[model samples]
Target: MSANSSGVVKVGVIQQANTADTDANLAKSIAQIRVAAARGAALVVLQELHRGLYFCQQEDVDQFDLAEPIPGPSTQVLGQLAKELNIVIVASLFEKRATGLHHNTAVVLERDGSIAGKYRKMHIPDDPGFYEKFYFTPGDLGFQPIETSVGKLGILVCWDQWFPEAARLMAMAGAELLIYPTAIGWNPQDEQAEKDRQRDAWTTVQRAHAIANGVPVVSVNRVGHEADPAGGAGLDFWGSSFVAGPQGEFLYRASIDQEETQVVDIDLGRSEDVRRIWPYLRDRRIDHYGDLLKIYRD
Candidate 1:
């Protein structure tokens, strides 16, 4: 653990499997955050939608009942913890913006009891077991950095992690680190090779974001088997919550099948050193990127 002039700031990740009970899930997350703070973590991140089961398995109108307001009970609890520990926290939640509007939101809680910033999930997936399009309205918050005591966090949700544009935009906005609160896993029916490929691809893409932006990347994903409400063999959430350095080196990695809380110290200033050596930002062709904003040309 390398400390700066101010002292070392340890970042924590909580990777846990979810059950059917929302209150129990929230309590478990709070306990984990307390454990992480006790271990000296200054910034802690929870897995995506940590309060309950991955209800996106099927799109029932009743599932909307799970969504709550931004400053609802969950945020209140996390905000209180953040203040009590004097630490920064990135927490994911299902936000009910209005009667008919909802969003997959990630809230950044500052060391104080106030809300720091929030980012609604931009990319909504509607795959076999992950049917998010029916529940969430695409995020209106653009790629922006949330300023906190620790550093500027470029917080994006799970599906948003795959887009380089999102990462680049955050870097352009002077974000120091790219943080993802994710809920991705493997289908039980997948072959061993396929499972390996899925996990590898997930990690590789996030690492690429770190390398390309010359910043650290922190990804916290859920673990264990979450049953698909539709039945059959459920989805197995490959834990593997990890943190990568500016040059894409692994700082810490959790197991793929257990609940773990790890507090890893990261040198926030290292990104400047890495970027000075590899000046990707200095050489970007911003003027020509107009074509990038367009859908593909035939």
Candidate 2:
């Protein structure tokens, strides 16, 4: 372990294959977290909505039962675990903020068993296999970094990973690392070539975030086949959870078809060195970038 000022910390990502049973899924995640902590990970991230299967594949109002309040059961369990292991934890959950409002939220648990902060996923997708907008309200938290014992984490959920603005704001806010808890997969009906392209694009975009922001990026994705209960075609979740350095080099990548608990040591200070050489932040003309907030220019 590198000293506090050095910004070096061991991080872990848990890539899991889920079944229909939520209880079983949560148990599996807890077990994997233990394994990661044992391997000396100071920070651990779980796959998006790891407590249950990807319910957004299709929207049924009945699936609302899956959403729980922030300080409810799931965070309680995670907070206890973080305190026990003395590690910072990033966990994604379907949040029931109120009676009719809900969000896809990632909660960061501090080492002292308190809720450090949370990020609601701002980018909601409404594609065929991903019907997130039908279920989630766009995040109101803005692109802010969550302070924790390990460091300030620029945490975002799956769909938010595609936006460069999200990553840039977090970095500007002084996030030490950018972390994403993702649940993305391939449509089984797509051609093999198409599947490969989709996976490659997903990985490439997030790596670009790391390189552009001059910060290490950690993304944990789910794995295995989840046959659509509504029945058209299933999704084969490509489980390639990965961690990349500030320069966008892969530190570790898990297998595409298996469940894994991967731990990698990262020198967070490297971001400073990378940014100093690239000077992306230094050269930014913040005053001239007002167009970024606009929807678009026709």
Candidate 3:
């Protein structure tokens, strides 16, 4: 796809905490989207599950009630807003595919208020307070990019951000930009040093993706703390939503402790120049990488 009429495009990310009330969370996200659009953002991306609190902190059968169909309420509301504002919108949802099936899906709304494509989260993490396997099924949609008026979006969810293969496939598929709508945070029980290390690693890995793929990356994570309703200490979501250029330079970064809506201009044309100089894609050793599909080489 060719670059927009101008060589630059403005993208925005919403990094705000969610409340237990789904309606309230949706309203907050809508308000932030309006703010971003008012400030000249052509494309706006929201944090993962922006409609409610991070329910995956602890598995509860009742949490399943939160899941809805793709064309359900959340998309209807956001789709209208996308058309009214005339901007591309990316939203993450808890999808209720059928009675017994569900997925952690991300939906892209085109500038004219139509569904572009969806990507189900492939990597589902199950850890201490985070018990996701009990909730979401693994995504069946392969690493495909969603083409839109702005560009091709390589959309991935929280845990999917950690895998180089996911990012690599998206780039090889011709994704102009990579996006992660994440909900990661610090374990309240962990020491300050460990928290810092975890946060730094998260940012570093995403930056490396941009450098390797020759595409800009936009990551939006929620802010503030949400308690673990099952009993233990909750997670303090570190809101360091950021944007990085194809060469891995920072374009915009939000604070770790505050709720913010910011727009950053990206030079889509830069990717062509970066790829020409650093031809990582052209030099790939494809013939020797057949083992990448194996679970283990043993």
Prediction 1 TM-score vs. true: 0.97
In model 1, which regions exceed 4 Å deviation? 1-8
Clashes of each: 0, 0, 0
Off by over 4 Å in 3: 1-6
Name the better of 2 and 3 by TM-score: 3
lDDT of 1 by residue, 151-214 (tens): 7889999999999999999998988889999999999998999999999999999999999998
What does candidate 3's lDDT look like per residue over 1-298, in tens digits?
A: 4532226779988999888989999999999999999999999999998889999888789999999999888888899999999999999999999998999999999888889999999999999777899999999999999999888899999899999999999999988899999999999899999999999999999999999999999999999999989677999999999999998899999999899999999888899899989999999999999999999999
Lowest-scoring 10 consecutive residues by lDDT in candidate 2? 1-10
What ordering of candidates by lDDT runs from best to worst? 3, 2, 1
| Residue pairs clashing, model 2 | none
Task: Estimate TM-scores for all models.
Answer: 0.97, 0.97, 0.98
Which candidate leads in TM-score? 3
| Candidate with maximal lDDT | 3
Across 110-163, the per-residue lDDT of candidate 2 in tens digits comes to: 999899999999999999889999899999999999988888889999988999
lDDT, model 1: 0.90
Candidate lDDT values, in order: 0.90, 0.91, 0.93
